[model samples]
Target: MRYLKRHRHVGDPLEAALADTALGCGFARPVQHEVLAGMAAQVPEFAGGRKRALAHAVFTMLGADLAHDDFGPDAFDVDALHPWAAVQVTAAKAVLGRAAGKAPLGAGDLALLASTQRQGIVWEGNFFIHLLVLHALADVPGMQATVDEGLGTALMYQRDDGGMPFVTDTDTWSTVTAGLALHATGAPPPVLHRVARHLLRVQHKDGGWSYTDRAQLPDTDCTTVALEFLHQLDPYAYRGPIRRGLDALLAVRGSDGGFPTYGAGTPSEACMTAAAVNALSTQGHLHHGIIQSALHFLVGSQLADGSFPPGWSRSRLHTLFRAHLAGNHSFRTPPPPIRSMHEQTLSLVRAAQRADGGFGQQDGSPSDAISTSYGLIILTGQADPAPAARATRYLLAQLRPHGGTPSPPDMLGPRPFPYDVPVLADAFALLALGHLSRRIRPCRAAVPGRRHSGSRPVETDRAQHHDAGAAHSTENTT
Candidate 1:
């Protein structure tokens, strides 16, 4: 560690020390430390006459990741870090997008970054997960203003009930989501204080959050998302509450190391576990023995084509409807279709991700932007032209000759939720476009139309729907 200081390799000495401690504790491998050190050496000290503090944070986080791997006797697997490469690719595009004035790395970019679940970010406890990722990668000259704007926009979605009203104020899921987004952008303390209080009061005795504060017993999705939000908002600030909540979560961890949606005996879910890993790892808790086993479980479960199943989301919706009926003696919402054809189909497609880049959500489905974006993130930074090209082709096909889709509904799969297509699908599409823009070098600028940019600023009143049902714990506004 002193060697860096002796050479003045150009970062905070304390950060270097932390990286050293993490590495020496076997958090990362010796070879990775060395490789990272080499990269750090290349990191010019005030060379551009101004330090890339943001880029430095990126390297520091990666360095810490190395240290956390426990200085493995087995060489560091470059493949495992593939996600970072893809992130870097997107980051580069974010830089380009910002420069080209295509779109600031706002909601769409935040969603993409949030999905990464990387470590060492200053979470600020807002709704924008990508903003946290951007904090480390935002090296572009005018990024802070964009951050401010994004924060303001995201904050506007917050509800009096302390949830982000995705389309309507009743959206508990998006409320917590909005809180995380605001935190990601480093929102003001006053805003975070309100969110924190809301989370605290709303948290169930089981240490999780559901549709409303009263919907107690805990669902893995909401629990994981809530825990992640708290961890990011103030890792140190909410340690006790977070740990208590995580304790409840730990009780549900399957012997296989993966987490079950409701109970321990059930088969493990990849997405739940992945979400759990993201939340836990972000809090520097990835070293837990259970997490290591869970990582093994996830890695082992990857299909031949390199994707995991739709575990949590896969529980038949009819079962959830029954559970909700039995628990409340009444149903609050209409019963949705049993199988989420699009979602379920996407799972199969994800499992079949091609080495070339495109992936199908189902075995036979054509590669599309949605699946490709997910696969690319899952693969990290690896170059997979097949998935990339196929996804690009799908997005292009959706275009109405005006460079944007004419109507948001046209791009939507058969699902009752409106936010899915806009936030989830559109975000994926934007990310895919960013990737394709780099890979194919499109002749003209590509901007997704406002037709689907979220029908109402995401903060207004919206219809009520719960595709995931009671068990899935979805909290969409409309």
Candidate 2:
């Protein structure tokens, strides 16, 4: 195994810049101090048990500093993290005198780590998962001995010239979302230009994109996201691809007038429809009959509490925020149905606010950084600033001094499998704070639509049966 002569910090200057941008967005000094203090105070809670303590120690070693206690043998747990993550955490703990003799690392542990690393990456090389594992290994004194060889193998999957993908060789979802966030947070033009170029190059011949470049199926979420990013970054330069993408987006409209995650036959979802409407309105495609049908579907989908059915995220706030954004972008003169749905959604979101100023995943779930961040972003332009302010306070309370926020574990994959990666939490927090500070730029320019020569029937793929009760993993998959 090849090893690097020297160790490097995984968290880069871009991450630090993002954190500073979030801070500059006008969080009060007292609020900042209070959040820092709160993070320190929560260390014990995170380290109270063996499972929790190991996770906490991993975060601290990664620079989040979630715990102050020496993570001794009592804190080590084989099942505390994802199996791959467990391997690295155990190694780090062993090196730190926390697991020596008591929970000593064995040959089996090393074999497992090497095998997992050799499998390339699961879920198509998710960046957060890779980053998490790298951070853990980098914390140990000699754990990076194999990093050079591992990274060399991994880099073989990178695209020739484009923004980094969520996974190797995929420039669809990750590139678009990252572009939006970075553009919003004032990332330089060269970076935005690079992202825009990659997006344009990878846009499927059908005018939309799949989660990964290799996946030919186009989904509403990825299509809309790509459109939104193009709209934000030099709309005119990439108008051709934007037009094709929008047309591809319209092609996926379900019979119910709502958008589905994948093909036409799939069930229409609120979040998918909301994303479509937002993209359409932003790009001046609001006049289409298909969009009106989507609007109706959105209004009809709202529950008594004004929440829409959760789509891709575990949190209702995620759906709510997307719906709200769709409404804002799509309607200059919303009809009664659209207007009523908007009002109800606002009330529901407001009512979901806990006394602690945080929002929960669902109506009765516990407060979390991810949900609270969504709530704050939704309330940013509202008439009542109180709720937004309160949510801001709640999010501030979750902030670690190292500029990362730790959210509760969220589910991923086709089945409900829990995955916890603190870097994701940090990314979302930065995005929400950036939005609140008005630092995030909005996409402009109306994309002109191209007319297809002949009418083609909307094609559908066989739908996978999903458990409604399972938390929808928000990994940008169709």
Candidate 3:
């Protein structure tokens, strides 16, 4: 017997043979990647996105035009929609109207609709969303049974505090990000080795890594970070995995030649492409023809104001940071950004700093630890030491024994909603602090147990920051 069918949508150019098949991993991937590889990219726009497409599809199946505000009271001809749309809208609205409340839905009244749920934008199904759909349907007839199955899945990620994360966790991301931070701070070789081992241990058969060990579907961001971490330590040793990951990453570039978060048909994000460029350079692909094309894409993507298209993050600094990373690794005596682009970016970053020496996700927004960290990372290596220095002071004040001050979520999920994974804050802050240690002298308080050995990128006492007190506090707070 096979798993029950979930959906039958494989719109556009074509579909997988299994598009109409029973649910399982088969239906989870609806697109025939090879066939759709030549199709145009679908950017996530507010006016016409996966949500709109899904609505159109549902209407088509219902033999109706999509219901719209344009069809208000007597604006458009309802006669044009006829009995078909009239009947379809009433019936569809009946079920959807029950989906009234917003997410974190405790009542079966609200729904977690998937405009496009192939991912929570980047990764696949997560805990909170499962509960969202489950709770939304629990009061409805016939859906009472799905509550057990859905809650069973959601509760797998339930916290000891009886709470759950939107996504269960970003184990692979947290590991590599935190590991890379700790690595820079001189984390024990054994600890770093274990991280490398875990990544290696859970790598998918297709030669990619996912956001968590439990997941087999991989994305460019996680895979690139994992590759970067492994490459940094021992490129020669991890060469096999690196090659495989590069193959997976390179395999999914859009027709535009930029990388997407996950494989095939997804929009090619500038930040993701930048990351791939950086990671690929570690493999000596900096001058490869593919890299050249990607570099060109990166150059063209930058706006006159010196920004690139935003990535999955809500942080303004995310793309700039990624672009910096990609630019730093290039071989045109360092390629991209050209002189004007670099100057423009530095100007914007400088202008965005708050008087408190912190940076917000956007200019004029409230200062926060994670965004400040991104600022510090961008400013640290610059010719001018001041902005980075001020950012360093800001984070220093905000530093808790746990990591950084609690910050707002900067990651966008399922398109518009935002969520936090907590460790991401810790990891980025630790990383920023490490970069900042370069320009300033550390106080006795900064280094609790260890001393910096006078390095180029001075190591902050992130190890001390995350030690005993932090551990206990996180257990209680998180």
By TM-score, who's the top model here? 3
Alpha-carbon deviation at 320 in model 1, angstroms: 24
lDDT of 2 by residue, 132-248 (tens): 345434433455755555565556555555223344444466577667767666779999899888887778898988767755556787899888878777778988988898888
Stretches off by above 4 angstroms in model 2 are 1-171, 285-288, 420-423, 439-478
lDDT of 1 by residue, 270-292 (tens): 55665566556554445456655
Error in Å for residue 338 of model 1: 34
lDDT of 3 by residue, 1-478 (tens): 1111222342312222232322233322334333222221222332133333323323223323223322233221223332222222332333333433323322322222322123223125455344434433546555555555555556466566544566766788788888777765667889888889988987887778877875556888888888888887777888898888878888888788788776666667788888888777775655477876777777778877777765677677877877765665554354335545556777888888899999887655689888888888778646566677678788888878865567777776433335677788888888776554433444234344444565244455442222212211110000
TM-score: which is higher, 1 or 2?
A: 2
Q: Which regions of candidate 1 deviate over 4 angstroms?
A: 1-170, 176-197, 211-214, 285-287, 312-360, 366-372, 383-478
Clashing pairs in 2: 207-245
lDDT of each: 0.44, 0.61, 0.59
Model 1 TM-score (2 dp): 0.39
Candidate 2 TM-score, true structure as reference: 0.56
Worst 10 contiguous positions by lDDT, candidate 3:
469-478
Q: Which candidate number maximizes lDDT?
A: 2
